[model samples]
Target: MYIPKFLEKDDVIGVTAPSAGYTEQVDLTKLESAKFNLAEKGYKVIETDNVRKCEKGRSSTGRTRAEEFLSLMDDETVKYIVSASGGDFLMEMLEYLDYEKIKSNPKWIQGYSDNTGLIYPITTICDMATVYSGNIGDYGMSLWHEGVKNNLKLLEGRGIIQHEFDLFENEYVKKITGYEGYNLTDKVEYEYISTNKAENFSGRLLGGCLDVLIMLCGTKYDKTVEFVRKYREDGIIWYLESFDLSAARLQCALWQLKEAGWFEGAKGFLFGRPCFFMEEYETDFNEAVKTALDSLGLPIITGCDIGHRPPRMTMINGLRTKVKFDGKHLEMRYTELDGK
Candidate 1:
């Protein structure tokens, strides 16, 4: 697997909206502050033409989004790229992406949620690693929180051993100052689903938002079966999460992925907290996961610091990983990485 070079001092970080662009004044303010913060940290920041423009929930046309992404990839100075926001239409721009060019260039592309449309395809089909983390806007907080700092540290090739965060945001809070930190409410716990006690397991890091991943399961972009098979020797540790999917839908989606052979060579599963889960038939998030994946008997860890919940860890897709869990907490270690 190809892992792009980590960020260095003075390297440029390009921001583009592959899914949706910011239109609200508060959003624009946060975006600008984020850019300024990165600049203060000695990294150059650049944005595409449509980052601040949104119409019909799109930054521009699909082709234009692909074009801007390609432009950043071609730029020798832009070592890393991030999405402006996550929305429903990222898949529309996938077909237009220059896959070959991206594979050849191999820059660090980072985003979460709808961005799975890009990162998933890039890692599984293109065979290059990508990042699943916060978008550029999160860094705009007047006081950078632990999540924001950890994200930047990861980009710098620090390979920090991310520990479980103390708390997580339970619900989405409206942006008032546009530079607000996470309104943390719930305590974080890496719950063991398949077993009552903690278990340690690791493999190639894979997975993303179920809402987006389910959309790509049968599409051409989804080379999941092939990708997992090819990396069977190392196994696969799926770190998954969901956004706004009901218990029934999540169960079906998990079944769909499993039937499609997406879980080939799986060692274990790590599930993050679901952003908005509509319980069905008295089934909760953990129950939905158990209803589908429990039969596998793999060491399933749930309620991790990942996905739409604030203060998520920086996840690297396609990297060999080692997860150490000791009942109370879990720490991730990357293999074949330099700066750990």
Candidate 2:
């Protein structure tokens, strides 16, 4: 596993739209807001052609976006690359990517959702770390929040990054007012809630949305048991999340991973909160997932606020994270390599 070092203050952060079409339809104000946010932290933001040219019907040519990403990776001055948003087209460009170039010059490739298709395979083939950070369309629109800014700050170094969620009664008001005024809770009672706080286990982080990972199965990007075992010689930690999936669908996905041998060499398992399909379903989605993971006898942590949630934290794909789960609390630490 290759541990890329945290970017320096002067390093340029490249922004691009590699999957979905942003083009002129994107909210320029939001993009500027994100740029200002990075600038306030004393970093440079470089927008790429991919962002400007991507449109719903007349987006860049087949491999244009992939080439743009590759160009950014090859540029020595661009230290970190962030996706503008998750879209439907990233998978088509995967085969055209320059893996060797990315492998040679590894840097942070950050995004979630459709970005997972790109990140998962990059970790497997290029041996470079990627991040599952929420995209510009979501958290980037509210860059003033401490949770959002601090999460970005955490990405600037090598250490375990720790955080907890405190949902507000009026989430909309709290979102507009900033997270500082919201009331926090320790009780785990909500329409959709899951929590896992577990022993310190160390491994290279690998995982993304359960649905996306499932789609990649049996393809070139699939991380089969044999593939994971080969990487396990170094160590492997898996993280997963789902959005509004049924308990049965979640269970089926877990079973698929189990059959593919994902659990065979996993050092630790981490899960994001599970949201149900509808309010009518009274079954506890968290408990169902916990039961599935428990059957594997692996050290598991549930209900982490890393996916499809407010104030989401950034998690690198191939980076080494030190995860400790006490009976009541869970902690995660990250360390970056000197030269990547």
Q: Could you say which candidate leads in lDDT?
A: 1
Q: TM-score, each model? A: 0.97, 0.83
Tens digits of per-residue lDDT for model 2, 135-198: 6644345424545665566567634356555551212233332212223333422221223333
lDDT of 1 at 284: 92
Q: Candidate 1 at residue 114, lDDT?
A: 94
**Residue ranges of candidate 1 with Cα displaced over 4 Å:** 196-198, 338-340
lDDT (0 to 1) per candidate: 0.89, 0.67
What local lDDT does model 2 show for residue 274?
54
- Which pairs clash (backbone N, Cα, C closer than 3 Å) in model 1? none
- Residue-level lDDT for 212 in candidate 2: 77
